[model samples]
Target: EAEVAQSPRYKITEKSQAVAFWCDPISGHATLYWYRQILGQGPELLVQFQDESVVDDSQLPKDRFSAERLKGVDSTLKIQPAELGDSAMYLCASAGALNTEAFFGQGTRLTVV
Candidate 1:
C-alpha cells in the first residue's frame, strides 16, 4: 500500500526566514491536499490538486505562500519570510476519486522562532 510522505517531522526557523516542506502523496491518487493545523484548532485547507491541475486554492495566502505539484505526484510548499504567526503543523494528504477517507502523513511541525 502506498502512503503519503513528509520530511522533517519538526522544523524551527527564524522569523522572516524562508521555509519549505515536502510531501509525496499516495500512488495512483489523483487528488492531493495541503493543510495547516494550529494548536487546538482543526486543520484548514491550504490548497488542493487534482492531477497536475489546481482544484482549489482559495484559502491559500498567495502573497506569502506558494505550492507546486510537479508531475502530479509529489509536491512542495514554500513560505518566504516566515513570521511568528506561521507556526503550525503542515499536513499532506490524498484521496482517491472513489475513496472518501483522506489519508494524512505525519505532519511537519513548523515553529517560527
Candidate 2:
C-alpha cells in the first residue's frame, strides 16, 4: 500500500533554535498538506500544495515557518528560531485528488525546551 514518508520521527531543540522536517508523499498524489497538531486539539492545516505550487497557506506563520514542494513530490517544512509554544506534532498527508482519501505519515513530534 502507498504511504506518506516522514523523517526524524522525533526532534528536540532549545527555544530559539531552528528545525526542519521532511515528507515524501505517495506516488501520483497531486495534493499534499502540512499540519500542526497540539496534543489536546485537532490538527490545523499549515499549508497545502498542489503539484509544485502552494494552493493555500493562510494559516502558516510566514514570519517563522515555511514549506515547499520543489519538485512536486517530496516536501520540506522549516521553523526558524523555534519557540516553546511550537512544540507539537507535525503531520504530512497526501491524496490523489481533492475528494480522495489521504494517507498520513507517522508524524514528526517536535519538543521545544
Candidate 3:
C-alpha cells in the first residue's frame, strides 16, 4: 500500500495553545489535502493543494487554522489558540495528477483541553 507520512500521531494540548502537524506525501504526488474528522463523523476537508498553490480552503477556519505545501511535496497544518472543539483527527492525503484515489496517512489525533 502507498503511504503518506504524518508526524506526532498523538497530541495533547491545553485550550488556547498552538499546535502543528506535518505530512509528507508520496514522492511524486502533486495534489495534497488536509482534513479534520470528529468522532463518529466523516472526515471534512480543510484544505486542498495542487502543487504549491491552494485549490480550495472554504471550509477552513481562517481565524485560527492554516495550511501550506511550500514546495508541493510536504505540507504543514497549524492551529493557533486552539479550542476544545478543535479536538479531532487530522488526516493528510495525496493523489496523483489524475486526482483520483487519494492515499491517506494514519492521521494525528489531537485533544484540546
Candidate 4:
C-alpha cells in the first residue's frame, strides 16, 4: 500500500532556533498540503500545492515559515526562529485529484522551548 512519508517524527528546539520537516507524498498524487494541528483543535491548512505551484498559502506566516515543492513531488516546511507557539503537529497530506480521497502522513511533532 502506498503512504505519505515524513521524516524526523519528533523534534525539539529552543525558541529562536530553526527547524525543518520533510514529506514525500504517495506517488502520482498531485495536490499536497501542509497543516498545523494544535493538541485540542482541528488541523489548519498552512499551505497547499498543486504540481509545484502554490495554490494557497494565505495562512502561512511568510516572515517565519516557508514551504516548497521544488519538483512537484516531495516537499519541505521550515520555521526560522521557532517560537513556543510553534509547538504542534505538522501534518502532510496528498490527494490524486481535487475532491478525491486524501492520505495523511504520520505527522511530525515539534516542541519549542
Top TM-score prediction, candidate number = 4
Expressed as tens digits, the lDDT of each residue in 1-113 for candidate 2 is 77899989999999999999999999999999999999999999999999999999999999999999999999999999899999999999999999999889999999999
Question: Model 2: runs farther than 4 Å from truth?
Answer: none
What TM-score, over all chains together, does every model reach?
A: 0.95, 0.98, 0.97, 0.98
| Decreasing TM-score order of the candidates | 4, 2, 3, 1
TM-score of predicted structure 1:
0.95
- Candidate 3 or 4, higher lDDT? 4
Q: After superposition, how far is residue 85 of candidate 4 from its true place, in Å?
A: 0.2
Cα RMSD (Å) between model 2 and the true structure?
0.6
Better of 1 and 4 by lDDT: 4
lDDT of 1 by residue, 72-103 (tens): 98899999989999999999999887357889
Alpha-carbon deviation at 109 in model 3, angstroms? 0.1
lDDT of 4 by residue, 1-113 (tens): 99999988999999999999999999999999999999999999999999899999999999999999999999999999899999999999999998999899999999999
**Residue 110 CA error for candidate 4 (Å)?**
0.2
- C-alpha lDDT values of all predictions: 0.93, 0.96, 0.95, 0.98
Model 3, residue 24: what's the lDDT?
A: 95
Instruction: Write one digit per residue (lDDT tens) for candidate 3, span 1-113.
Output: 66999998999999999999999999899999999999999999999999999999999999999998888889999999899999999999999975488999999999999
Q: Tell me how far the alpha carbon of residue 22 in candidate 3 is from the true structure, in angstroms, after superposition.
A: 0.2
Candidate 1 achieves a global lDDT of 0.93
